[model samples]
Target: MSGSWAGGRFGERGECLLAPNPGIMTLDGTNTWVLREPGSSTAVVVDPGPVEDGHLERLDEETGDVGLVLLTHHHLDHSEVAATFAARKGCAVRALDPAHCVGADPLADDEVLSVGGLSLRVVATPGHTADSVSFLLPTERVLLSGDMVLGRGTTVVAHPDGRLGPYFDSIERMRSLATAGEVATIWPAHGPVHDDAGAVLDHYLAHRRDRLAQVAAAVERLRDEGATPTPRAVVEVVYADVDEILWGAAELSVRAQLEYLAERAS
Candidate 1:
């Protein structure tokens, strides 16, 4: 998981077409997954990704006939070309958010989508963003975790739209799936794929709890020092080891943590 995650086929029915866009935030770029059952004539595309013309063209050429396009969320990096790509393939785009859907109704939680003999169960995992969703391939015991979980690092709990309470709940839900043996592998939308789903879910939960505790302690320490326990101030203390360039993302999580703490107190 430390090295670069070059896109390639995985599991029995999934292939990762890594988008060209990559950065600190995107890691190895948005993973545009092509899911098709063996011997199927058409495929299903997930998170069509950015507006890269070459990427879209490659998807069109490589995938042949795409039956449908699904979005994990409405983030520009993930869904910027969903509608356009779907239209080109003569398919409909489905997402948790209606605004992002094209020629198709919004996806419902627990909805079972069957295409090209592949079965994908929609799991609403709103945390990284309110519209975030994960697709569960029961036959493969794989979860296509959008931005809710990443292959390399922790996901940012984008505040305002992303709530800490919901984020925690979502992680817990995923953890339960892992514990129940329903999810054995995580085919995330970013970075590499994880074979140990339970371990990863546990790590994510523990990391969040550790960060929350650290944030709480930092707030108390700042208050005792007669300094306002602002999000940035708490972030400086809690995320001291993190790079300054990622402070903006840390601040968003800090804000969400603060809000979660406030709500719990009330």
Candidate 2:
């Protein structure tokens, strides 16, 4: 809330319209991206954010003649207005989850979508959620990372639906893109844009490693004291510095970590 994440135009084909929802979890708000190729009449819109009257009105005005609507994930914050907005624009909504799509097939891994002279490569990055995915604009060298990568801090690996193992694989896949110079900038769904994709991805990986180590140590210490390592208990020890308001989110991540540890042990 201290920092400004007022979304704006970036690269050659993308413009961000920041939503009104701001909170502890949603850094500033969801980034509703309007992507159009230069001189193209039709464009593609991504993650049409929450159902706010003003935000939707602004989006309707900014995004003239939308060719298609793309979703980073099925999170309500990002997809609440996707169908409605797509309906208004007379376009189809597409996501990794078919349930989220309207009048379009579910997005396939490594699928290349060409619309309005712009090309986007769909990269399956299901870690934050089972249906999570990222879009790679090879021409712009930009990655539209949904909740998988945030502009401010590390993203949470929600338990049950979100697994640490898949999250690790997703991060490594993104890192490979950055390291290969295929992706230079990260246009995250929340918070501000990142210039150096490689640096940010490295930080995300390192932070997750540190947290995993801390969780392991906390679990071991608890077991030594003849205590059961519950998710809340693990969170209390590992995320002692984090705000209490975020304990719920922290606990979700702890559950994922515990499951990951169990899997590794097996």
Candidate 3:
């Protein structure tokens, strides 16, 4: 039991089954969500999580007769076992990316899917990755925030597949959802459930802004010293506080920051 998670039932129709693959990156491991309507025979599982046999067995025991499998993104940790698991459960796997889906079409924005009687409205929130998405469960006012939002700390907007502009837009969209009273809680894919949706969104937005500003300042300082302000150089100055193991992840975000700055200049 990590300080950030305790695997428990959340909202009116969801439960979290914490995976065994916890680490510096995946805090308390990946969260496999099981959602079902009251007295409904069918359930929907989200983020099947790595292809670990024990994890799959635990999920099978925790969620019986799964009707649909939903994926937030194509990250291996979250989507590796999805197709196999969905096949085992006799269900269709739907994701934003066609390659990740099995025997079903990719999801679209505002697309609503049902499991028994509960519904999940797909919210396209690409930032963490181009295919990243979040689900809004209107009945419980809970949002299944994939990697777009984490239950603890902040998320990395790694480059190539991630962009600062779209990431900010996605967070703003989620904030708008909270402001409109469409969502009140966050059912993140990692860590524990967040009770205050408004505060979490505010923090996520603030943290991204703060980090970008800090990275910008670092870039300026590096340039003043007549040195190249590359992503690795910027990481040394901006991500000094982060562990060396996470420097690789930090560098990825730094790359995205550099691209965003370059676009602004252009």
Candidate 4:
């Protein structure tokens, strides 16, 4: 909250603004983005962050006239305040899910949504959440990656709603965009902005592959040591370097890893 709201220009047709909401679960706060059409005053707001009063007020103050409020997913941290904020701005809340969506317009994969002369191409990026999506601003070659890719660390594939194979596939999809030079920058839902879209995508892909390998190794080690292959035991051995506080989250990852291994073996 101390730093001034940072805004930057993306190519000729788009502008990106970041509102950092630092705290638990939010990492360096959620990155609330405002993408506007060049030379236009109206803008589209993405992932308004948590429903904190201050954050909402700051969003209103920063984005003078919002043409739309779009949620990348239905997570509370991202869309909890969508209804209130959309009502305040007299804009409709567009999302993939109806439960969290303020209006009836459900976002479709490959859908082109426009506001104020700027358009965002929706890319279905499930596995972070079933409803998770990434927005591609083709004109600027910038992607609003929601929780699919984080500026730092890997995103949790919150299971039940998230899965490993699909998550890997989603990363590959983003990687294709970067490799094709269709995306140059990543405006993630959390943490700082990333300019090296291709490199970031590569890193995310590598990280997940390495993690799967590590999980497999950990399971093998447990077998070698005659340790029970329970989820808790695997988490303890595999995530020993991770903070104890995050073990719960690690356990979820371990579960996903186990499922992956099980499926592969079958």
With candidate 4 superimposed using the best TM-score fit, by how many Å does residue 194's alpha carbon deviate from the native?
A: 1.5
Write down the worst ten-residue block by lDDT for model 3.
1-10
The pairs that clash in candidate 1 are none
Write one digit per residue (lDDT tens) for candidate 4, span 1-266: 12333446556654444545565456767777788888888889888877665888877777889889899998888887788888889899888887777765788999999788998899999878788999999988988899998767778878767788888888899989988989988888876668899888888889878878988888888889988788788888878898898888777777887887899999
Residue-wise C-alpha lDDT for candidate 2, range 1-266, written one tens digit per residue: 13787988897798999999988889998999889999999999999999875888889988889999999988899999888889899999999999999999999999999998999999999889989999999999999999999999889998889999999999999999999989999999999999999999999999999999999999999999999989998888888998999999988888998999999999
TM-score of each candidate structure, all chains considered together: 0.98, 0.98, 0.97, 0.91
Report how far residue 30 has shifted in candidate 3, in Å.
Answer: 0.4
The alpha-carbon deviation from the true structure for residue 260 of candidate 2, after best TM-score superposition, in angstroms, is 0.5
Q: What TM-score does model 1 achieve against the real structure?
A: 0.98
Give the lDDT of residue 77 in candidate 2. 93
Show the lowest summed lDDT stretch of 10 residues, model 4.
Answer: 1-10
For candidate 4, the TM-score is 0.91
Model 1 lDDT tens row, 93-136: 99999998889899999999999899999999998999999999
The runs of at least 3 residues in candidate 1 whose Cα sits more than 4 Å from the true structure, single-residue gaps closed, are none
Which has the higher TM-score value, candidate number 1 or candidate number 2? 1
Whole-model lDDT for model 4 versus the true structure? Answer: 0.81
